[model samples]
Every structure is written in C-alpha cells, then in structure tokens.
Target: MVFLLLSLVLGVLVGILLPFHIPLVWGKYFSVALLAAIDSLLGAGKAVYEDRFDFWLFVSGFITNTFLAGLLTYAGDRLGVELYLAAIITFGVRIFQDLSILRVYLFKRFSTTGPQGVSKTRPETK
Candidate 1:
C-alpha cells in the first residue's frame, strides 16, 4: 500500500513535469481508459481492505478494463455512436461504489472502542 501510494505520487509528479498531449480525436479513448484504470485501482484497494486481494486478478482486471474501454471508444468513433459514454458511466459508478466501501471499511476499522469498552475520541496512547 505504501509503495502504491508512492508510485501514484511519483506518477503525478512526472505528469506535471512532462510536456505531453493527446490528440483531440483520441480524447474519448484516453478519458475512458483513465476511468477504467482508476476503477481497477479502487477495486483493488477495496479487495485489499477485505483481505481478498489477488495479484493475478488485479493485473487481469486492470489490463482488460483499460483495453476494453479504449476499444469501445474507438469502435464508437467508427460507428458514429456515443458508446464511450457507457464505459464512462459504468466505470465512474464502480469507482464511486468502491470508494464508498473503502470509506466504510476504514471508518469501522478505526472508529471502534478502546480498552475497557470506552469509545475512543482520540488516538490511542502507547
């Protein structure tokens, strides 16, 4: 988890420092692919919280979702239909749902009572 956080921060820093651009025609594909990647990351985080994180599953899901989203966007452009919107909505909803679950898990994990059955109003002392 720490590694993942560090990598994310590094990626953001690099993105900010780099000069790159995606062509306008490929904007839909980029957006959908990014959404898919985010959804996969959130899903992986939730799985980790649930103690069910699988390396293979995360790898396959990340690749498949990203590829399919980009493919859908490309196909939609070819067919003159807004199919990429479907990918966007699906991934967006999944991302939000994953975040909600993670939030609840974290709250439950950290908001419990302390010793002697007393509710913890602040950080526990050593």
Candidate 2:
C-alpha cells in the first residue's frame, strides 16, 4: 500500500512536471484508457482494503483492460459504431460498485467508535 500510494504521488508529480498533451484525434482512445485505468486503480484499492491485493493481478489487469478498451474503440471507429461505450459502461458500473463497497467498509471501520465502545464524536442526547 505504501508502494502504491508513493507511486501514485510520483506519477502525478511527473505528469505535472512534464506537460504532455495527447492528440485530439486520440481522445476516444484516451478516454477509454483513462476509464480502464481508474477502474483498475479503484479495484486495486478495494482489494488492498480487503487484504487481497496481488501485484501481478493488478498489473496484468491494468494492461489488459486498457488494451481491450483501446482496441474496442479503434474497431468501432473502423466499423462506424460506438463500441467503446461498452467498456465505459462496464467500467463505470464497476467503479461505482467498488466505491459503494469501499464506503461501507470505511464507515464500518471508523464510524462512531471510541474507547470502550463509546463514540467520541457523537453528541449526547437529553
């Protein structure tokens, strides 16, 4: 987890420092790839929280998801159809579901708890 967090921060810093711009014509591919990346990142986060993270799985899944999404986008362009939406919808739903589960996990872990089962942040009632 420390490694993942550090890597993310480093990547953000490098991206900020480097000022790279993707071509406008590649926007569809970029969007799909971005969604795939977010999906993998969120999935990895949930897996880490659940104590089931696998480095190889995360790496392979990220590569595979991005490749497939970009391939579908390219194929749709060739066939005059919007096939990338499938990847978007699928990843989007998974992202939302993972976020929901993570939220529940976080709430259960941190909500209204204090020493000896008391809630430190809860207000006293009359």
Candidate 3:
C-alpha cells in the first residue's frame, strides 16, 4: 500500500520536473517528485536485497534520469518543461505497469479455483 502511494507521489514529481524548459513552473514540485521517486525506488530495492542498503536504487535512478534530464535539457521548449504533464505521464505509466503485474497474478489465482471448490450463487440477505 505504501509502495503504491510512494510510486504515485514520485510520478507526480516526475511530471513536475519533466517540463524543465517552462520558466514559470514550480521548482519545488519537480524537486519533490524526483526525491520521492528515488527514495521509493531505494526503499524497494533495499527490501529486495535484504541488506538495509540503498545504493542500487540510487544508481539506477541516477542512470535513468541522466538520459531523461539530458533529453529535456536539449529540448528547450515550454512543453518540454511542464511538471504537471510529466507527473501525469509518470503516474499513468506506473498505474498501467502495476495493473499488468496484478492481472497476471489474479488470472493465475482465479484459474486455479475450479467451479467445484468455489462458491457460485450469491449469499442470501439476512
């Protein structure tokens, strides 16, 4: 649950920073988004590695963002620097990714619950 929320917050931050060329954009949002994403990713990776470490996620985020930041830097267009848009894009991508992963798990579990072992008719009201 916390992971999902963190992903969403990070995505929002991503959106904020993505429009780096927009002069009037709020720097705070973008910065927060970037920080949140990195922090969340680090926490997750640390949990996976089971060592209370965060280097992996930090490295991965740094590597991915280097390319992303460079692309935005070169664009120099108002559209290219809009944080809101970037956040929306990030949120959409994460949501879809999670949904797809969930779909696979749900399908697998449902497939195993054959008709004979599962309830069919709805329960009667008391």
Candidate 4:
C-alpha cells in the first residue's frame, strides 16, 4: 500500500512535469482505461484492508481490467454500439463501492464504535 501510494504520487508528479496528450480519436479508450485502473487500485486497497490481499491477483486484475476496458471502448467504436458505457458504469460503480467499504473499515478500525458494531475492540493493554 505504501509502495502504491508512493508510486502514484511519483507518477502524478512526472505526468505534471511532462506535457503529453492522447490523440483525440483514442480519448475514450484512455478515459475508460484510466477509470478501470483506478477501480482496480481501490479494490486492491480494500482487499488489503480486509486482510485478503494477493500480490499476483492485484497485478493481474490491474492489467486485465485496464486492457479490457480499452478493448471495449475500441470495439464499441467499431461497432457503433457505445459499449464503453458498460465498462465505464461497471468500473465507476465498483470504485464507489470499494471506497465506501474502505471508508467504513477505516472508521471502524480507528473510531470507538464500528460500522453496525462489526469491528472488534482491541483488548486492554496491561
């Protein structure tokens, strides 16, 4: 998680310092791919917070989701069917859901009361 955050910060800094632009024709693909990547990252964070993180799974999911979202956008362009909407909606919903879960997890872990009282209290220290 620390690595992920650090890399994200570094990547943003690099992107800011660099002036790069995607072709207008491929803008949809780029946007959908970005959304998918964000969803994957948030999902991975949620998994880690839940103690079910898997390195391989996170890597695979990040790559596959980004690729598939881009592919869907490309295919939609070819078919004139707007299938990218499906990818966008799916990833957007997942991102929000993952964020919600993470928020609850953090609040429960740090606060006196848990969400719906699901969080366990730490034993009193001697």
Query: Which structure among the candidates has the greatest TM-score?
Result: 4
Q: Give lDDT tens digits, candidate 2, residues 1-114.
A: 579789989998997898788889999999999999999989987887777789999999999999999999999999989999999999999999999977766665576653
- Winning candidate number (lDDT): 4
Model 3 Cα displacement at 34 (Å)? Answer: 5.0
C-alpha-based local distance difference test score of model 2: 0.86
lDDT of each: 0.86, 0.86, 0.51, 0.87
Give the 10-residue window scoring lowest on summed lDDT in candidate 1.
Answer: 114-123
Return the number of clashes found in candidate 1: 0
Candidate 4 weakest lDDT stretch, 10 residues: 117-126
- Candidate 3 per-residue C-alpha lDDT over 1-126 given as tens digits, one digit per residue, 9 for 90 to 100: 578689879977997889556454545445545544554454444343333446666667655654454345345344566454554466456545545544444454457563553332222334
lDDT of 3: 0.51
lDDT for each residue of candidate 4 in 1-115, tens digit (9 for 90 to 100): 4787899999999988888877898888989999999999899888877677899999999999999999988888899999999999999999999999888777777787665
Number of clashing pairs per prediction, in order = 0, 0, 9, 0
What TM value does model 3 have? 0.30
Clashes of 2: 0
Cα lDDT for residue 111, candidate 2: 69
Q: List the residue pairs that clash in candidate 1.
A: none
Compared with the true structure, the alpha-carbon lDDT of candidate 4 equals 0.87
TM-score of every model versus the real structure: 0.82, 0.78, 0.30, 0.84
**Pairwise lDDT winner, candidates 3 and 4:** 4
2-111 per-residue lDDT for model 1 (tens digits): 89899999999998888997889888788899999999999998988777789999999999999999999889889999899999999989999999988776666676
